[model samples]
Target: MRCAQFRTALSARLDGEPSGLPEVRLDKHVARCTGCRDWLARAQRLRAQVRTGTADGPSPEWSARLLVRLGEDRTGEQPPGPR
Candidate 1:
């Protein structure tokens, strides 16, 4: 399956929704795909941030970085920073 498909499944899994795809298949893909793995990590972080509301909201730097990461994701580029 393409990375996009796997990403959709990942989002569903993260949200506790059925992905209609087998868990093993998704796991296998994430295992070897660095881009998807990174995407998943970023998504989890974003979710956590949302759940734990900040007093003043996300910082400008954080927002900008997120936008850049998302743009890179859409273009299939590996985002800069930690793996």
Candidate 2:
């Protein structure tokens, strides 16, 4: 498989989202391509970090603030004119 093709499916492969033929192809490509192998390693590390909570997790307050900001941006409002 071409590097671009393998790259496009790399994330899905790491996430176990590929299936059958694509999965096999990606697997073989990863095994043979050092570049793809590095990408897979980085993806796996990032996924593990996210799962283990070492990475930042969005808090409820942050989500609320982000939603409020998004709403304001969408409506083109000035957030109550900054008090």
Candidate 3:
């Protein structure tokens, strides 16, 4: 399989959906291709983050900025709403 095909299959596999025989081909390609292997590692990390729910929460800076914006809005600027 080509790099593009492998990447598409890899994405599908990460989502846990059936990707048919193409996925096997992509997996084989990844075993032999360093770039594809690195991509797979990244995909696995992101997948783990999604599956384990570790990516669900917001960052501290987001809340801090929100509070600052809220304070500004209360002082008659604009609401602390999303852009």
In terms of TM-score, which candidate is strongest? 1
lDDT of 1: 0.87
Please report the candidate that would top lDDT against the real structure. Answer: 1
lDDT tens digits, residues 1-83, model 2? 46877776887666778633466777888899999899878888889998898776798778767867766643456466554
Question: What's the TM-score of each model vs. the native?
Answer: 0.65, 0.55, 0.62
Instruction: Please identify model 3 stretches exceeding 4 Å from their true place.
Output: 67-83
- On the 0 to 100 scale, the lDDT of residue 35 in model 2 is 92
Better of 1 and 3 by TM-score: 1
Q: Candidates' lDDT values, in order?
A: 0.87, 0.74, 0.75
Rate residue 59 of model 3 by lDDT.
81
Clash tally, candidates in order: 0, 0, 0
Worst 10 residues of 1 by lDDT: 67-76
Assess candidate 1 and give its TM-score to the true structure: 0.65
- Candidate 1, residues 9-64, lDDT tens digits: the string is 99999999998799999999999999999999999988887888743577877877
lDDT at position 78, candidate 3: 61
RMSD of each candidate relative to the true structure: 14.7, 5.4, 5.5
Global CA lDDT computed for model 2: 0.74
